[model samples]
Target: MSKKNKDIEVRIEETNRTIKGTNYVINQLSIGKKLVGEVMTLGAKEHEAFLGDEDLGSYKSVDLAIEAILLQHNLHD
Candidate 1:
């Protein structure tokens, strides 16, 4: 099932910065005013989700990552 952006307010911000020699595109995920998690760009259409310091695993798309975040956090509609 696909999640619709109806009841929840989701936000994704890209942190364009390179650490060491790797180009890190950290997308900060938030709900309302509270930060829920982050999605790190692994490659083209590949992303890794994290809640705080715990790795949530890799996803095929950003939407999948966000869905995982919502499910894990019990915030899905």
Candidate 2:
């Protein structure tokens, strides 16, 4: 594939998580190290608030970001 085409591609991986007592759908993109993005399609205002806080903002890489999300859900077990 061409470099130009690669830049337009977005690969997403889905996982279930819960933040602040509500379940959320987490989407992880296979992009650059610091290019992690997330979307929570199911949750209340508190869940969104927690996700936007400084504790979640400390992750600097996509892998770490995913890890942080997993940790939030206690999914590591």
After superposition of all CA atoms, the RMSD between model 1 and the true structure is: 5.4
Model 2 Cα shift for residue 28 (angstroms): 1.4
For 49-75, candidate 2 gives per-residue lDDT tens digits of 123333455333445555565455343
True lDDT of residue 64, candidate 2: 57
Off by over 4 Å in 2: 1-9, 32-35, 43-77
Q: After superposition, how far is residue 3 of candidate 1 from its true place, in Å?
A: 20
The segments of candidate 1 whose C-alpha lies over 4 angstroms from its true place after superposition are: 1-6, 75-77
What is the overall TM-score of model 1 with all chains considered together? 0.75
The alpha-carbon RMSD values of the candidates against the true structure, listed in the order shown, are 5.4, 10.9
Candidate lDDT values, in order? 0.84, 0.48
Per-residue CA lDDT of model 1 for 1-77, tens digit only, reads: 99776887778888976878888888898889989888888888899999878789999998899788878877533
